[model samples]
Target: MATDDLNKPLGLPRERKAHRTPLVALVAPPLLIAIGLIAFFAFGDGPDDPGNVVAAIDDTSPDQTGSVGPALTPVYEAQSEPLVEVKPTGGLREVRGNDVIISDPSKPRPIRLAAAPFEDLIEADENGLLPRIGDDGTRPLDAYARPAGATEGMKRIAIVVGGIGIEGEAGQSAIASLPGEVTLGIVPYGEDLPATVAEARALGHEILLQLPMEPYNYPDIDPGPNTLTVAGGTAKNLDRLRWLLAQTTTYVGVMNYMGARFTGDDRALAPILGDIADRGLLFLDDGSSARSRVGAFASDSAPVIRADLVLDGDTAPAAIDARIKQLVAIARERGYAVATATAFPSTIARISAFARVAEENGIALVPVSSLVRADGS
Candidate 1:
């Protein structure tokens, strides 16, 4: 009977025991929860999240293995020189020291002729139709450039740079990477379009003026410091355009930079297109607008060539590479492809490297205008 009473007298120890049980129970649930959370995070399906999909498929390409698109084949070449001979100092017609008349035949004696189309005046505008006489007298400057297919053994690639806004270290370096025979595009309103064009020309790259016009955002969009706007009336607009185009001495043609409003206005652009034709220059419409009047107007008015693709619309290195491959494929398929891409460190490097690949694949990079003749067959 006394044993039960003695056990009951340990009241302080009993109370401590009761408090310890609840504390242990309370702590166990939280500790277990923390461990479960760590396990879930460590082995969870995180990669399957929507945020990772872009990273996964960003660089994927159908022809990732470097297979060419179509076999290249020859389309055309010059049979004979197409330039006309002009005599200097020999009479009413003469032949002076390297000087000859490049005047248009359509005009009368010192007359006014509708300056022949860009392709037609090739021999006249740039020093009077002598065809850059080689010592052998066999070179043909007026002859059509030969069009070729991307066969198993052809190696040619056109390198194109679309945007050149201002002269920074990065811009200079990007321009410097272009190889011989590559084509370059410069902004007509850049800090120094003339200097940039001349520099590119000296390096043996063909040049084009990237014209700025109204974009989708219109008044809201600043197309650099100088842009051709509809509100400026046709005459002022034309004058501004002409001045911009003239700023670059090296450009062989002009291409649209971005034009949402102008592209929709056939009536306003018709005369501008006519002027482009009148000036013996080609026009390239960068595919910025689905309702572009430039292409149709060009077909009817001048030697117009529109850009097929903007290669670096998305500037990721891998994306640029895929687009380059796609352009190559398209060029091979149609015997020629014309694309424009902005100048970026990654894009320039990738394009410079791709030029080598193009040569290996027999895809020659040419001016956008060359494709018309290339695909004429």
Candidate 2:
């Protein structure tokens, strides 16, 4: 110990003093954190303070100067009337609020039938003019139907070439090439539908309104705009149906586009069929779904016609020809048959060729209206 002490510097302390942290350093961090939290709770934007939030302001309020301001009472509470007011356009009926009142059953007379829509057969609505049964006991079904050919004691076949107005060139070709006896079904969603329908009618083809309806694989396989669905209630579906009916005029009947699920449900289908019957229009079941309940609910006044076969299920020419042969056999066995097809080139060609030899083969090619049987025989 004495030797080590001798080696050490004379002015240096033998043991270093114990180190201590400054009091301010230890306390400052926690004090600063507490102060920051207190300041945030007291002065920050809280639930009660909605800073710079914009809301709907009442334009009619004199106090509001169209400047950004705090939200007043809810806009809905300040008003008790409907958002929009609808007035009645001149028609057979007058619109009072949402109700339609017929003016006089004897006063509004039926207009003369023509290629254009009959004025008495139309009722004006918010959407457009919709087809309606005339007050003088005239039905659109009878007015628009192509006169049926003599089918007594002979095999009858009605071929419906649908999907007209969808593809412009193809539709025009179908209208030009096919015989007038083959009914043309017009889709409402197509462009220039009125013109297309007018052209078809001018060419002596009877028209059917091809309405879009919900299929089994809906949403994934949508039928397009204004498609009536099973999930939509009766009121909503009827409104949609009216919108479709207003698309064009001079169609003899309504045929479903694709409606597997909708036709299977009696609750959903009955009201629509009833509405069609009340308006004096026929309903054609395309025979796409075996589970369809159309016949059960159809009215006696306007019977529904179910298709015997679909001619172009397989769009190949040979397949279509074979189906046509089968259709002839069905007509021979049942005395009458109704067949539907798309406006495909192959289908149009096959049908055009078959139509030439149909009378020679003892088959009378008739319009769809000729096949309507009330007894469902």
Candidate of highest TM-score:
2
* Clash number for each model: 20, 0
lDDT of each: 0.55, 0.76
Which pairs clash inside model 2? none
Estimate the lDDT of model 2.
Answer: 0.76
Candidate 1: regions farther than 4 A off: 1-159, 165-167, 373-377
What is the alpha-carbon lDDT of model 1 when measured against the actual structure?
0.55
Candidate 2 residue spans exceeding 4 A from truth: 1-114, 373-377
- Considering every candidate listed, which one attains the maximal lDDT? 2
TM-scores for the candidates: 0.57, 0.68
